[model samples]
Target: MDPHGYEHLTPAEAIAYQNQLRQKINICELTTPIKTIAGADISFDKNSDILYAGIVVFRYPDMQVITTATAISHTSFPYISGLLAFREVPALFNAWNNLYSKPDILVLDGQGIAHERRMGIATHFGLLTGVPTIGSAKSRLYGKYIEPADKLFAESPMYDNNELVGIALRSKPRCKPIYISPGHNINMQQSVDVIKNCIRGYRIPEPTRQAHLLVNKIRIENGDNRTKQMGLFD
Candidate 1:
């Protein structure tokens, strides 16, 4: 599927697509002792002509890095808001395929139920892969919440039309919060707990932080100098 063509999907078509996709996601085929978790994110070249993705897998409790994969593809879609999954999925899944240790859960840098039809990249990928997944993004795509001032687990529930969508979690003191949402096979609180369990030093969790670094590293190694492109916060 051409990411550029996603824009052609009408509002009704988008909703239908989402409904069709929901049929494939069970959201119950999940393991509690998720021994492995993976993180995925994408980056574009400064020229915005190339897309790069990184996937990092980590063992639970111990948090040992087990595997890493990186992939690059010609940018197939223009940078369009609300149509980001189309742009990133092609290359990102390639990276997912390259990994040796399949993770029990996947963390994406997009939303889960924060989109037009309560679907975003994380939800899309979760359904496509049938893996328990969640979205931990840095910004809000929709809904409203009272931003918490405290750090270290300060959070507020995010809502849209009174529907619980996600949570804004502050993992660090005085730092911006990360948006948390269930992608598949998880609940809202579990999403937050999983993210909290994965944190190490940085604002983002270790697996995701490493994945972000690796994507940027790949960009640099491939001569993709997009002003270092500034890593996506999450």
Candidate 2:
């Protein structure tokens, strides 16, 4: 494999690659207006070989799905903690190539700078694609915090060793909070605000939720060899 390619890296190499790129991740406030947002996700078949990736672009605030792209490919990597980008991002790259319009920001259904390794899928993908990205995950990866209020828009800081890494966000009343983190070219607060704007009465942000549904639909239409929920990254 090329030095930066994910094709043939061992688990150790993958971890090292993440650490190497971690320094390049930029978590800064979004300085411009966003009129479009893209949500991305990937799913795998049994034995973790065949992978499906999807991207859903939506008009900001309105959350209207405007464009969608999907791709399927075989992966050689296994499921490993802190190194999921290797298993998922290649297929996403394929789908990204098919997009007719470029979104202003990408909201992914996985951890971003909130990761234990500081290089989750969203962060890694952002660095690779040169796109601003945010991570809005359904569960915690590495952080601790007091629970945010259950009401919609409630949120609290998530910290790793006293360093604030992300937010535990309540997107809807009575639903479990989802975690939000900056991936690249955007800061934590900006990420939170973007997610809040994309929500449409659902637990997950609308862009990511729509992308999740699209990938699952593709998986089902193609054939589900396994009953497991799809891996969360794009």
Candidate 3:
């Protein structure tokens, strides 16, 4: 992995590489119904080059906060489109390794199956960790959306050159839609249902929303410049 561009792995072996990544995480099946889901997000101080990674765990369906972990690290690589997982996954894992409770499914704040090779940051992370994950991005990475007028779940199908990749869903009535896709060991509809259940009267799900804010919160607390209240949409 060169830590830049899509040159880390070839498109031919990307799927197999992803499968290899998923094999590392111990996918323990729960005897009880799923009760918790977590989200992870990261922010970078472009000036100082410090990375702030945050994780928020919440009770499933109910979306109650359980725990939070945030870690700071140096940037591993410059931001690139396809190879994004390598840049932030290290810091995210740092935060995740410190958690007492592990989540059943991770609601990632990035794209999943909606990628060109079905391996965006969310999918790459899920595949690497073997944790079932979903992408809940604020913008459509690569898709055409109908942009529904009335429903909170105003959905539009995501496509990559005629391939149906994922769904763009508006979890709230007026708020922007979240780009959703199955990351690993999960179907698209289940991903959508799980994300919807995690909503706690906000635009993004509680876990992700909390993690998003917490990422900047830690930066601000540490006197890092990544906490500039810039526009959410980029």
Best-performing candidate as measured by TM-score: 2
Candidate 1, residues 127-171, lDDT tens digits: the string is: 767688888888889778999778688889988878988899888
Which scores greater on TM-score, model 2 or model 3?
Answer: 2
The sequence of per-residue lDDT tens digits that candidate 3 reaches over residues 1-234 is 323333345544545665555444322232346788899999867677578999998887777788888888776355657556767777787787788878887878888777655667777777666678788888776666577565876667777777767887778887877778877767777777778787767888777888989998888788665336444444
Native-to-model Cα distance after best TM-score fit, residue 209 in candidate 2, in Å: 0.7
Those runs of model 3 whose alpha carbons end farther than 4 Å from true positions after fitting are 1-32, 226-234
For candidate 3, what is the TM-score? Answer: 0.81
TM-score of 2: 0.92
Instruction: Please tell me which predicted candidate would have the highest lDDT against the true structure.
Output: 2
TM-score of 1: 0.87
Superposed Cα deviation of residue 160, candidate 3 (Å): 3.0
Per-model TM-score, in order, reads 0.87, 0.92, 0.81
Q: Which stretches of candidate 1 lie over 4 Å from their true place?
A: 1-16, 23-29, 226-234
Give the TM-score ranking, best first: 2, 1, 3
Which 10 residues in a row give candidate 3 its minimum summed lDDT? Answer: 23-32
Error of 1 at 26 (Å): 4.3
